[model samples]
Target: MTSDSRTLQIPEHQQDGAAQKSCYQKLSDEHVEELELYRKNGLHPVHLGDVLNNRYEVLHKLGHGTSATVWLCFDTQTSAWKAIKIIGASHSSDDRPELKFQLQLSRSDLVALPTDHFWLVGPNGRHVCLVMPPLGPSVSSKHQTMDLEALREVSMQAADGLAYMHRKGICHGDFRTGNLLFRLDSARINDLSKGDMLALIGEVTKIVVETDFGEEPGSISPRYLVHSLNTDIFADFITCQIAVIGLSLAFEITKPPKTSSVDLPYASPQLLLRLPPSTHSDVWALGCTLLEMQTGSVFGTAPFEIMQSMELLLGPLPKPLQRTWSRVYPEEMLHPEGNTEYLTWRSDVISEIKKHTRNADCLLKELAMSRKQSLKGLLAADDKNKPGSIVWQVPEKQVTQIGDLIKQTLSYDLHTRHTADAVVQHVWFDQARIHRKPRV
Candidate 1:
């Protein structure tokens, strides 16, 4: 079917030139999916109250990505909350390697697998709909002021999840904070009545899609676009059980993926160098993820910039890779001018490193202050009266252990990188007190 067949038909008033073009309300792209994408092989138009397969009732939009839109749905038959991911019609269910791998490891608690699957024939086209247990927002979306204990919990859970996947011979080609979702309290969430759930999540914000001549959106787009569900209410119920998600780039160890589309900031040197993806590359990405979680920022924004940061932080690139880097990015491009006095690249690299280091230091300082305050409260002593407080200093042993672990995973040589299993068993993770209690 042609894209035109799926698009909303222009109103007769506009066709006859009776209505003014300027009368229509133009919708902002913010907080909503692109209206232009609702076509023949694009996103399936899903409304809040719509029911799919005569069972799952769409409650709110959980999130969306380039290829699919995830909705928080209530399954009438099972009376359970589910996150239904509706893949774009352009992608075929049978051809998706993600589906194959997820099905293989469906029983894994560390990974978010589809509990059920079905096809939805919409105005756009037939799309693959995956039913999964609803999960909270990604770790990357969490507040930067997250406590050290919570951070440790996230780190340990993520490492454990990755280790599980690696043990199953699956390589999560794109391993990053964005792909790690915090597990919600299923029993608590499921037990909530529809009205109670709505009250907790707050009202859904929606905007009417206005077109030229005030044309109805028709079947192409949703009648009203819904803002993604606010999951802040579930923050207290968020568990340490993190699940590794987004398996579209995942591949098996025996059959390496021919093509990879990892985000540049999280991508390993092997991937950036155009080498085939392997489990080693996943480890490199994991290192970057752990560092991001600890520091509240990525190492760099661009590929060349990240490579430069990698060199400074993880030591110089391997000899062969250094030669390849020179070939890829010539000296003239990196240095620009022969004069060392105005070396912007070097200055920029130094600035970036200092910025991240300062962020890490700030987090460490916060942790130390928290510890000091806790001790003061426990001892019930004033700062001036306490002689032991003068000499008391928070130990940096955990910092050193975590640094060693990250260094091992972010090793220059892929062979020298820590395996996923080793990362989980690291000394740093031992400090993580695994508990489901609410964050203080």
Candidate 2:
């Protein structure tokens, strides 16, 4: 790709919306409603033959979300491919202006933001159209699978990216697995060229979709690429997509809000409880996202279900949540009238499970001890009734270390939670660190 280094101001205005509207002006507003339906229900408003901003040609629809419909397009000026996010919301106020912020960020390692963004008024109204280098696939895209090492790399980089955003006072209020991108360049560590990486990807995902996100900047890969040479180049090929790609940021990336519907599965207890949002909440999102990237599921279906899962997987609610439980959660939410499991906590449970560790913070430790004792006792009682039943075991040491960090990320108390900066250095990422240390 050539360097169109023309001082990098935003692109000039696109082809006039009026000019484009003339062809369809004969159609009644009722007919236009049908056109609107094109994008509303997973159809492309612009045909493949159409051009955007007179500079971008619509290639195909990559994906769509609540706010905008994304199109893979060709940038005539830069002669590169870009993803165009056309905001569906009529007002421009809802769009994120961080494309400029992304271009100016101090860290070059972050490939999660687009190369550039600009606006275009459309037939509907003024739309804050974001033009950025394509983000390859949603981290949740069905075509890919990653092993543990690949996942670790993705987690560490994600944490580092979140740290960079938080330090800059930018809350990527909607950071989740789906928003993350995987860019594919040639796997240099594997000694594979760009062509090889492409071939590897085809073998991995098992189906060929459009693979181009952007060219890798140089022969040297980023720090996130330092994993043990994975055997399945196909998986890591998709994995390294994260290693060598540029990303885009669109809307709602402002100061952390009290709450937004966008933050699901990863929303912190504080935010869920209608408390003030903070940068630390982003840290919580990073943690929750890493867990889902591994587990491949949302935290739960509803708030109550999520709370139960978290309490079981991590420890109980921190003291703050406990204190407000009555005020915030109704009896139905805490213990649905028909669900006996919620009411079974008493002396019987205290005898079965033991405290996991004595090293947790005082509040966490006490809660952990109590919850575990109850859980263990209940399990023992069930076993006594059944005689010999299948046994359950705790996660191994390394896994427990990682689980502990995840719990810290999911901590109800911000004080007990792990910061994005610290999470990158956690023991869970130790193996990846060892590989990078020698080279650094």
Q: What lDDT score belongs to each candidate, Candidate 1 first?
A: 0.72, 0.51
Tens-place lDDT per residue, model 1, 315-427, is: 45666876666566665555436434222235564465555542334444554554456545635655464323221443577666666777788887877799999998887
Instruction: Determine which window of 10 residues in candidate 2 has minimal summed lDDT.
Output: 218-227
In candidate 1, which residue ranges exceed 4 Å CA deviation? 1-30, 95-98, 330-394, 433-440
Q: List the residue pairs that clash in candidate 1.
A: none
Best prediction by lDDT: 1
TM-score for predicted model 1 compared with the true structure: 0.79
- Cα RMSDs, all models: 8.7, 14.1
